[model samples]
Target: MKIRCRSAVFAAMMLLLVLAPGVSRAGYDYVDISNPFLRKIPIAVPQFKSFSGTPEEMKRARSSSQLLAETLAFTGYFKILDPASFLFDPQKDGIVAPRINFKNWTTVGAELLITGGLVQTAGLVEMELRLYDTFKEKLLLGKRYKGALADQRRIIRRFCSEVIYKLTGHRGIFGSKIAFVSTTSGNKEIYTCDFDGYRPHKFTNNRSINLTPMWSSDGKWIAYTSYAKGNPDLYIKNVREKRGTVVARKGINISPCWVPGRFELSATLSFTGDQEIYLLTGRGKIIKKLTNNRGIDVSASWSPDGKKMAFVSKRSGTPQIYIKDIVTGRVRRLTYEGKHNTQPNWSPKGDRIAYTAIADGEINIRVIGVDGNGLIQLTEGQGDNESPSWSPDGSLIVFSTNREGPSRLYVMTSYGTDQRRLLEMPGEQSEPNWSPNIEGP
Candidate 1:
């Protein structure tokens, strides 16, 4: 695909020299620590134990172990062991003292084991967990994570994340959610789903066009571009409170992203003389001017640190990705590998940036380092793969592709494995953005 850049080649070169130092490296913050090529290890989880409370009072005690197993297994790691087939009773000490039979677990090709116990004291719940290395016959990580009975699931998610971190030294995204634009009915709407593409429940029932949804760092609200009243407008949706509000109702205000520190949001508003990026406080106060280019400069995504920004610019004649320094207000193009690259989505870890590339008239999702190196193409030969969204852990990308049939949600590994389609089918979905599952947004 051929990309048309309005900025002259000479002009782009000159801009690079003067603006290179000014471009803030503050925009993308998701760190790339996971190795996609490594094979996942086998693991075992004996249902977590309980000491004081009844099985029912333990809340997630009975299912917490299974949930952890499934969560780790779905991540392409830890082939879990089935307790029914094991020699030991998984729930033996589940309601009391828990002990693991290492030999029994090793007999079934298990390398790692995870055990825990739930204890309720004076109407409060507390939990203890232990991870063991079967071969070494020693405890790998044994620590007690205590939380209220109401927070057992929360404790489980955190413990599971800790296990992943101890094993790979990289944070896990098992508890994250993906935010995307789904058109289930005749009208386009915004929806939220798990990172694995499961439990895709709709959040917006408005009969309007909403696109480019972004989550705040706090994960309390979601900012999206909607055209309910008429022209494209920006709206914020809170997950827990189940509240939605219009941030920008007039002009072509789109690509709303929250700046770090929760000070304000950075968005593009055409209400100005032309389309340019601006920073607005949480209360909708314009704080600063981000871009001054006469060309189409929009889609500003903040780096994890909130210092620099990565946005799509036509200043180079064709649409290409560029990184700008916030301190001095200079810019440099990050993508020169493909033409017509747009929709630069920054990962939470601040490691990789996913975008759409036009090749032979086909749009395929691709990823590259923020420095414009280590370019890797994830989708090839699909109908048209666009809107590459990163899982909060930077493990996979949920994108929409018109493959085999119509435009449906397709989830792929960050390194492009298990290219599976989500949903049974029958509608058009596009522009997926994954959110950290801390709160709502």
Candidate 2:
């Protein structure tokens, strides 16, 4: 079979440098993310100015403003203020710092404000965006971007990343992708979508049973188990090059997980008469056997620092989560309450691991500390929630759930709050693997 891959070469947007650095009083400490009961910052984003005043410009103006609001709100950090409640207008009033009125924004209990102006030409758009501290009455961030009109979302996302970093001291998850298994094409094939579930398209079209799409650490490759041939073999394909290698061992090759900051990965191979995890190179060469247990040992999840791995083992009578020190070869059980626990995913922060457990005939998601202390359920009584994957920033967890109906992708805060559906499509989706942030804008 031939794999078709299309790659986009993004030209850097022209940046108009007119921002003053030390004008705003607010600093990086604006939002304390560590707070369990963090308050959502109220932000007012009025309609962007249509400098051309043409119908096309006006249409994009409204859509772009709404997209900006939605993008920021998706971070679970901001509350978008209604446009009807705004006292100032983008058309009549000024968007610049000199001709702005901060009291109008602060009066409506908005601590932050974002204003934009857009101009469109034949095929390109030029936008100027500004973020302000309403109480301090100063410009916090300002930038001008020029790009194709179709690239409006990317331009807005770049600005949003800057907005988040200015406030949170960390770049937000704006350009990441999530890969999962879906039956949309009448078979269990691999599909991918943008971080917020936009632009979902099939990643694999083999019309076979493709499962567990795992992204490499560099976001350049994806390793998955495919029954395209006869047996369950591991296929590692470079997402951009359209070429790959196959690890068709003797019995079975499954559960491929990449090591952090390296070209190596670990997968469970049953070729040795017993299922065990083995570390392999990116090109599919066995480096060493990672486990030598009598029972089945699979589903390897690596810690952020690559010092430890958390996997599922049936060595303790029932399937449970276990952590292994890569250096010392010391293994310890992490979960004991559940009879069936699997699909362990280590958080990027290296503090917790999320896994799926079947309790009372119900499958749900749970998070446990690295030291096996704090065990809390993230989803319950909601239909089966399985395959929990953490975002690169460690702020959110994406998992597949059947709470409403057929299994679909859902995302929630790390603490399991603000649970919401990620996307809707024709068929069921499961086993989502989130990619790291793409290289550039």
Candidate 3:
């Protein structure tokens, strides 16, 4: 295939070409992510065949293939087959449909197969990837991409997104990001990383205490509470522009959560003597008070449709989660099993809420249905796990835990399986907020 480019100094635009014709998206029902007793599908990933014999081309071929497998395996849906047990050889066998041996893949119990090919010349890379169904001996998805050599990770992620959408009918989290607070520079500051905890960089250099970095519904802005000016204040800044508005009222301002599909957010502002949640515009203008109770109310999590909100309230003598109907102004307690239930995060599907619950001097993560039934504890006996946040698709939850050592970010399936650490840095990390699907560089 012929690859074209406009500029060498600037990053080249990736070109995608679909090789398959008239494939129905609904034809594949390999995964039902909502099922609790889900069995992982077995998939195989082999080294890509390099078209050029140069050492640089072979290095890219080996690394890109492994990166592809790692990206797909990060999702708890797949069991990547060992490359050492592969029967088909990329050096002698074909990476295309006509030349692939289906029996060789099926013999190793591979339900799905992926093959890749690489071509590099003059600092540009061209990749052709294909996904196959081993049993049916059919090509499920195929794409060709051409871009700069530096765009290897981005190119692989784009292909992985395509592969996930082909199987699950929903776009993957490869395009999303996670924001959290870290003490890497001897001060609490906000940092952003990719969904798989890659490319973590400091987002704020406030040189003071920063907490609860919340992403806007559009993913362009972040709101967090910083003590840079000597008081707990809410600062809303554009992620790329580094310009924002500050809500530096008389008292404390914290726990900012964005409303679904809107520019408004609910935050705990204590300009008054009492701590309560209030609705505010994107620019720090207060629209109205959302809660009014003698007990302290804060940490508001909105429903998917913005018709209701779930928050923490001490009105019932202890901190418990409560749900409020935004239309009729009716409040009802959602959690009664725990006295110290805080940090409630509503699911993207609006059917459940995940929160931090403290019981018997142990803090763990728990999820209960919206109707206050089916309470299940996710973490136990390891260490304190707090600040649970849901992925955009509601298939996974990211939280902070001190299970091994200092607090670090961890991700698990929605059903509380495949728990693993996401990233490690110089200091503790906490309060991870997952962002929505973003489309850009």
Give each prediction's root-mean-square deviation over alpha carbons.
Answer: 13.7, 4.3, 1.7
Candidate with best lDDT: 3
- Model 2 collision count: 0
Winning model by TM-score: 3
List candidate 1 segments past 4 Å from native. 1-37, 46-65, 81-99, 115-129, 141-155, 169-171, 194-200, 241-250, 421-428, 437-441
lDDT of each: 0.71, 0.88, 0.90
- Please give the lDDT score at residue 324 for candidate 3: 94
Q: Compared with the true structure, what per-residue lDDT tens digits does model 3 show for residues 1-441?
A: 554766533354788888887577746488875672289989999999888767889889999999999999888889999999998777679999889999999999999999999999887899999999999999999999988887888889989888888888778788789999999999899999999999998999979899999998789999999999999999999998999899999999998999988888999988888899999998999999999986689889999899999999999899999999999999999999967999999988889999999998999999999999999998889799999999887888999999988999999988888899998789899999999887532
Candidate 2 lDDT, tens digit per residue, 359-436? 998999999999888999999888899999998888889999998889899998888887899999999999999888
lDDT of 1 by residue, 91-208 (tens): 5533212345577778987777787676665534556676667766556565555444445455666677766666666667756777777778777888887666667888777798
Report the C-alpha displacement of residue 142, candidate 2, in angstroms: 0.7
Candidate 2, poorest ten consecutive residues by summed lDDT: 1-10
Cα error, candidate 3, residue 177 (Å): 0.4
Displacement of the residue 345 alpha carbon in candidate 3, Å: 1.0
Q: Candidate 1's error at 354, in angstroms? A: 1.9
